[model samples]
Target: MQRTISFADKPTLHGTNVLLRPVQASDVAASLEPDHEADRLTGTHPTPGGLSVEQRQDWYATRADHADRLDLAVIDQATGLYAGEVVLNELDDDNQSCNFRICLFYSRNRNRGLGTEATRLILAHAFETVGLHRVDLEVYEFNPRARRVYEKVGFVYEGTKRQALRWDGEWIDAHVMSILAEEWAVHRGYPEAPAS
Candidate 1:
């Protein structure tokens, strides 16, 4: 039997530092509030007015029903709190590729390796479980830290879309990166590991 990919069935993935599970409504109230620093780092545009709490809750409440994409809440195991989110969207069944993204709502969650572990967990699911051929993402050039995490997970730089984001009267380049199933088989999402 051919193994199939189904985003409809939500899953819980455990990692050393984090857990990836379907987003809960509580996560919206507790960890999904808009943060300017996260938006800037992820190159997301701030809503002109911002979403009402109800709107956000409704969004998270229905994430489990989406069949075409997977949205997982990043839970910090050490603190047992909702630290952030990791999403796999823009699915291309024909090509077996998807776009990847992640964000941590609070600064305390940043630089703690939670994001890296969360990323690896999801990528393993994408390639090992879902059998996707490729997973891609875009990172603003201004955020080298994020790019480094992507690199550590085996995503290779493909190219850059020049000045893809204009923020604060400045142009920011967006770097496109991707990892292939073949690559994942070799690295298992730890491309930076020193060979023993």
Candidate 2:
């Protein structure tokens, strides 16, 4: 880990399956469209269709300008197409930690290890290259798939925020999970090594 923190470089990190690069306006087709499954998994509450496409475009257009947080577009290597995004935001510089999130745009991208690989790549950049002491994320109990991915990447379960979200008439618990730089040193991303 470096002594200083920096997300200004907007790095292009590569994996065997995907490439993580800075997102641009040209990557903005259907990104603003409503994804019901994505929304449910992330527990995102829709706000009456008031989202501005132009504003979203402007946001994507200027992703490279931010120095405080990392937002990389996940691109499928075989197709050379935009898959989704993985982000590290809410930087707490004093504590050397940040919040993490990832989302894929299409159904074809799910259940195929894209999110897992993307999580591993960004967390690597966070702890190994970006000099963060810790990276954390929250996953609602309804989304076991995401929780499992975080666990596979070595994030320890911190605790649960009870009744944190209300959806489809029932309350859900949000689990807080985190991984420290030291833990990354031991496991990198995979907590358990694959069978030789």
Candidate 3:
């Protein structure tokens, strides 16, 4: 029987340095702050001046109403502040797969293994709790650090989508990567070679 998927049961995933919980309205203010580095790194080109308070307010306020996707807020354990978010969306029930994405609000949250831990927490919930067989992502070539983080969490390089992103008058390739449930059962987010 094919396992069905529902993200309605948002989880509060805990780690040594980060915590993942259902997104709340309070996180909106922090999210409104512009992170140019994050936008560039993630290949996101948002509307001029980013989201206004009212738009963000309505969006976050209704996060729970969607049962098709899981959206969780990442909180830094040390500072107890909303650092970012980890999402699993575009669910394919028959294939038992979904796409994963994560973003931290500010540069201060980068390079500290916070994103890595957050990624592992969400993947665990995806493969273990949600009974998903696969999770995939696309990372732009220019942002290698994010790709490295995904690889560390057991997502293997599948192929590349040439000119996937048009940024700053240049086209950039986006690398496609994925991880399987069986692979997660082995590494549990830490990639390693099977014994020969």
Candidate 4:
């Protein structure tokens, strides 16, 4: 029998540096701060403008009602502040797979290992608790730091989508990566292979 996974049980996942919990409307303020560096690093399209307070609040407020996807707020444990977000979306039940994405909204949250811990916590919940068979992601070629983080967590380099993103009139490649449940069973988060 195929194992079914439920994204509805939004659990608060704790790590050494970060805590991943259900998103709240109160998170609107911290999460809405605009950072050009962050937008560039994530290869996000420039929105016409920043979201209004009401729009952000309403967006976060409805996160709990979505059963098909998991959206968690990344909290910096030391300061207990909203650091960013980690999400598992585009769920394919028949394939027991989903897409993973994470971002630290501000410069303060980067380089502190918060994103790494948050990534591990969510992947653990995805494979061990949710019984997912696969999780995948795409990283822009310009962002090797983010790609390295995904590699350290056992996501294997699958392939590259050439010129998948167009930023400021220049095209950029997007590297595809994925991790299987079998791989996760062995590595959990850190892979055992010797670093090249």
List the global CA lDDT of all models: 0.89, 0.88, 0.90, 0.90
Candidate 1, which segments miss by more than 4 Å at Cα?
1-4, 32-34
Which consecutive 10 residues in model 2 have the weakest lDDT in total?
1-10
Clashes in predicted model 2: 0
> Mind giving the per-residue lDDT tens digits that candidate 1 earns over 9-114?
7899999989899997888767645588898988778778878888888899999887779999999999888988999998888788989999988789999999
What lDDT tens digits, residue by residue, belong to model 4 across residues 1-196?
3437668788999888888999999988886667887788788887787577998889889988977899999999899999889999998988999999998987788988888889999999999999999999999999988998999899999999999999989999999999999999987898956676
Clash numbers, per candidate: 0, 0, 0, 0
Candidate 2 vs candidate 4, lDDT winner = 4
Cα-based lDDT at residue 156, candidate 3: 97
TM-score of each: 0.95, 0.94, 0.94, 0.94
Candidate 3 lDDT, 27-119, residue by residue in tens: 898877678889988888977776678878788879898777899999999999999999999988888899999999888998999999999
Model 3 Cα shift for residue 2 (angstroms): 12
Better of 1 and 2 by TM-score: 1
lDDT ranking, high to low: 3, 4, 1, 2
